[model samples]
Every structure is written in structure tokens, then in C-alpha cells.
Target: MSLRRRIAAVAAGVLAAPLVSVALPSAPAFAHGYISSPPSRQAQCAAKTVSCGAIQWEPQSVEGPKGLRSCNGGVAHFAELNDNNKGWRVSNVGRTVTFNWVFTARHRTANYEYYVGGQRVANISGNNQQPPATVSHTVTLPSSGRQTVLAIWNIGDTANAFYSCVDVNAG
Candidate 1:
């Protein structure tokens, strides 16, 4: 091949590389985060502490639109998490308890919100950085009772958020 032809081919290949990648299907987004500690409803399902359906396979993926309050996080299939069941193990927690989030794929978070009995308790502003494998937050519960704590992870750049409902007996 001529040097000019060779150089042209190389240049063409270099220019097309990015386009090819953009055209191809991207990697599977294992992109989900869920509360594992204090064992959220989904966490219980994953741990077999509670018998559940598809949620057992993807506890971290219980996500939905942002700014909405729902146990399933707007995921209708996961509505069972809202169902009252004595089988769901309750964690006895203190006034200040730490909840751990296990992320399969990290996204820039907007903020972390904790709610109890339909009231917002703690709000941790996100740093907008890709979070590590596990993110822990120590929240001070302003009230006490056998209440379910709903933890919401709001993504900074997206209109979606992940939800995890943890059953806890505030002691």
C-alpha cells in the first residue's frame, strides 16, 4: 500500500473508533444501590430473611422517579415491600444509627434522605461524586417507635432515585 493510503486508512480508523463505540450497545448497567445494613426490605429478601419474588435477585435495583415517596420507589412489582408482615425482621437501633448502602454501580448522588412515619428525619447532601462500594450514614432518629425507615438515594444528574425501606425498632 502507498504511504498516503496507509496514513489515510490510519486516520480514518482513528476517527471512526469513537463513532463505533458510540454506535455499539453499551455495557450492562449494573447501576443500582440499596441499603444492606439494618437490612432493608429488599435486603431481607436478598438475605433470605424474608421470602420474596424478583426483588430477591435485584435488591439494589429498587429504583424509581425522584421526589416521590413510595416504599417500592414507584416500582409496582416491589410494592410488596410496603406490605405489613411480621416475618420481616426488625433491627433494634439506637437514637443514632448508621445505614449502609451497597452499590453495584455508582452514580453522582444528589442527596440521601431518611424518612420515618412519613416524616423526613435526616438529609445528607451528596458530593456529586461516584460513591464507593459501600456508603454509610449515621442518622439521628428524632422520634422513637417500631417504625420503618425509608432511605432514598437521589441521583444528582438524573430524574431518578433508589429506595430502601428498613424495618427498625427505635430503642
Candidate 2:
């Protein structure tokens, strides 16, 4: 090839390489899941029942390191969920109540845990498989009164878990 032609071909390849990369798709944001039934804190935010910050835009992103007891999964932008006086709507139910979880991105789960009054009330095994769009667990309240239930979704393949808090008046 002539020297001038070689220089032109090299320039064309270098310029096209940048355009090819720019046209490629980028990674998607990890928006997972949250509890909907009985209206978890994130649900309320998504529904506009409670005014929240960025969590309202993405209720299914309350993900963090496993074993976290925080409603917002310790995410700084969702700190409002950690507020005790956020005026969250409370759902009234019987001693035996069923909690429902809605998943946006189904993942292989290790287990599902529910806690009330600092005590675990139920632990449903996920069997290390992907769950359906929605999953439910029934648990009897320890006592009758207003309480906050913390629901946790432990991912089987990751060191993270999704957190949600539901206020309820169990009778």
C-alpha cells in the first residue's frame, strides 16, 4: 500500500473505534425489589402517600449489605425511611397477617425474614432459587398494638439484602 493510503486507513480505523464504543449500550442500573402489600415505607414513597426524596423515584432500590436492620438499607439518600416520625400510614390487621413482597428484578434468594419488636417472627426459605413476581409469608403478631415490621430479602448469590419497613396496628 502507498504511504498516503496507509496513513488515511489508520486514521479512519481510530476515528471509527470511538464511534463504535459510543454506540454500544451501557450497563443498566440495579433496581431490584420491595414489599408492596401492607404498603412498605418505599411503597408509600412510590405511591406519593408519603413525600420522600430519590427513593420515591425508585422504590425497588433499597438494597445494601446483608444483616442491615435499616429500612432504607443504610442508603444515605433514603434516610427518610429511617425516621420514626415520618407519618407513615399504618395498616390494621388481625394477629395473623400475611406480608407480601413485590419483586421487579427476580433474583435467587437465600431466605426471607420478618421481624417485629426486635424479634424474628418468620423465616421462609427461598431454596436458593428465583422467586415469582410476588411472594407472601404469614406470621402471627406476638402482641396486639401498633408496631413496625421489618422485612428482609437476603440474596443467595450476593452479600446484599433488600430492606423494607411496614407500620401496622395488629389486633
Candidate 3:
């Protein structure tokens, strides 16, 4: 190769190195975040009210067989609080309570929003800046009793969908 061509090639290689290094080889990209769920074990609601009991929440990947998969470069997981055989009945007086939904994401930014009973509650943008993990916000349940909680990715429209009931007795 000519001297000028050789120098130009070297410069191009140097410039492109960073881009190449950052590129992922074969993994599919998906948006990611956290989701909370009703406990796997059965339980009773709080004495007179339907409050969610003490929960050991954990982060996990969002995966499914069909359309329920995670978004680009992302994984989805759930936080589970069980009922302990206590049934959650909707409050007849229309009371309100606050619950928290925590989450994390992988590559790309984590833009997430929380919804309860079809109403928007909390939201966060640009959450995940580094790779292999990024923690977002805690979504609050605005009302009480058997509300369907949704964690939506505002960026790519992905979601960790779950239906959990909030009891009036849980503190």
C-alpha cells in the first residue's frame, strides 16, 4: 500500500476502534425495567382490610414465549408480595394507599412509568447510563385494593405487566 494510504488506514482504524469495541456481537436489544407482582403463595388480607403484607421484593428479567418478551437490550423482572390466604376486597368507601415498585435496567436509558387502576403515578427518564445494570425509581400506587399495577417503558413501549391487589390492612 502507498505511504499516504497506509497513514489514512491507520488513522481510520484508530478512530473506529472505540465504536467496534462498544458494539454488541449478537444479542438482541431490548428496553428493561422492574415490575412487582402478587405473591406466589396464598395468604389472607390484613385483619379487617385488604393490605398487602410484608414482601421480599427482588429484581428479575422480563421474559415470555410470545409477545411478552423484554424490549431491546433489556431484561424484565418482578417484585412479589403474597396474600397469605387473605383475600383483597375493594374498599367500599374508596380509600387510597401508596405502594412502591422498584426496578433496574441494562444497556440504553431506562424510561419508566407506573400506573395503577389505569392512572399514571410515577415516572423516570434516562435511568440506566452504565451497562449490566441501572436502578430506576419506585413507582407508587395512588389508590388501594386489587389494582392492576403496570410498569411501562416510555422509550420503547415495553412493559412488565402484573396484577396485584393492595389491602387496606397492610401497613
lDDT of each: 0.89, 0.92, 0.39
Which 10 successive residues of model 1 have the least lDDT summed?
26-35
1-171 in candidate 2: lDDT tens per residue? 999999999999999998999999988676788889899999999999999899998999999999888898989999999998999999999999888899889889999988987899989999999999998888888899999999999999999999999999999
Q: Against the true structure, whose TM-score is highest? A: 2
Tens digit per residue, CA lDDT, model 1, 1-171: 999999999999999999999999987567699998988999899988899988999898888998877779888888888887647899999888999999997899889999987899999988887788899999988778788888999998899999999988888
| Candidate 2: regions farther than 4 A off | 1-25
The segments of candidate 1 whose C-alpha lies over 4 angstroms from its true place after superposition are 1-28
Least lDDT summed over 10 consecutive residues: which range in candidate 3?
Answer: 37-46
**Model 2, global lDDT:** 0.92
Q: Where is model 3 more than 4 Å wrong at Cα?
A: 1-33, 36-105, 131-136, 154-171
Cα RMSD (angstroms) for every candidate in the order listed: 3.3, 3.9, 11.0
- The superposed Cα distance between candidate 2 and the true structure at residue 14, in angstroms, equals 11
Which of the two candidates, 1 or 3, achieves a greater TM-score against the reference? Answer: 1
- Candidate 1: residue 72 Cα off by (Å): 0.6
lDDT of 3 by residue, 1-171 (tens): 999999999999999998998895867434233432222111222232334333222222333222231221132222223222444443232333333333344434444555555566766675554323434344445555445444444433233332233333222
